[model samples]
Target: MTLAARAPVPGRFRRPRALRSERRTLHSWLMLPVEAVARLMTITWNPVDAFFEAVFWRDAKRPGKPFHGGWNSMAGRLARAVVPRTRNGAHVVMQVTGHHLRLAYVSSARTLTGAPGAVELGWYTDLRDVTWIRDRSDVVGGNHEIGFVDGSWCSVHFVGDGWSRMPDAFPLRLSHLDAIPTAR
Candidate 1:
């Protein structure tokens, strides 16, 4: 079946049957090692994230501010130092659904950077595609379904060590964007 034609399996986080099965098997095999590494990374990074959040990222719970000279700001510098960087510029679009958030990157936008035209962009819809999502008081980590406008979809897991530098970093990136509504 084509991507859009496929239905999500019934669950909190739905995924394609074939992909789910493959992931299940792979997760089973790698559980121990993956867990070990994840635990180690979390142990090492969570404290740093907390410190940074306490100092530079105090506004992490507020809606994100747009990326204006973010790199020059202390929060932006901390975000760059700790959070993983994407090659595409930082103009992300965010949509908050019930219990879920959808994010997309504006790879080309003249308004964002005063650059002309569009660049070839890659979309990430899954957990792996996003580095972090900061909610009030807590940082979430889990797998979620991600789909692109082109009808491509995948399941992505959150990186164990990822954390956001500002509460509003995500919302700010999405200020000018709209979420694509999905049928229940």
Candidate 2:
């Protein structure tokens, strides 16, 4: 009954097979009626400070694990424990620091957007000055098309395995890689 310890968000995973980019802690069993309408749409950032390596344990024998390279199926863990994927409306929160790559939204009824878990429509990249891509699709899903450095470009939606762990935490180029379209 003690939880605390999760790290890795400084751009390092060495992809060969990676999972989790860290500092992730999500929970929404309909967070108070979906945060009373997503806290009027949480604008983002409630972390005065953070560092989490990722972990979720539940082994009443076995079968409840996600720590590090997490990718599971057994019918997607019994259909995500009786349906609770929230269809991407689980109020996003991502942090990949070593400079910047923050996109926020967190609410424990803190009322997002001006302090207290906010980031209404935010994006701040610096993935070494952007210019990225890592597409994947089989039915139109999974992306990461940044192109910043002030040139402005965005196309995120990267779900699952984060495109096989963004070249082990950024270092991509080979036309930025893309080959997951068995017909999409």
Top lDDT: which candidate number?
2
Instruction: Give Cα distance to truth, residue 2, candidate 1, Å.
Output: 20
TM-score of each: 0.20, 0.23
lDDT of 2 by residue, 146-165 (tens): 33333333334444445446
- State the lDDT at 97 in candidate 1: 40
**Residue pairs in clash, model 2:** 6-52, 6-53, 7-52, 7-53, 43-118, 43-119, 43-120, 44-118, 44-119
Residues 1-184 of candidate 1 have per-residue lDDT tens digits of 0111122222312211111111223334556687678878867457888888778866655343322222323222222322222322233333344333444333322433566423222222333223332232221233323332232323223332342333233322221133422322
* CA-lDDT, candidates in order: 0.32, 0.34
**Tell me, what's the RMSD of every candidate?**
18.3, 17.0
lDDT of model number 1: 0.32
For model 2, what is the C-alpha lDDT against the true structure?
0.34
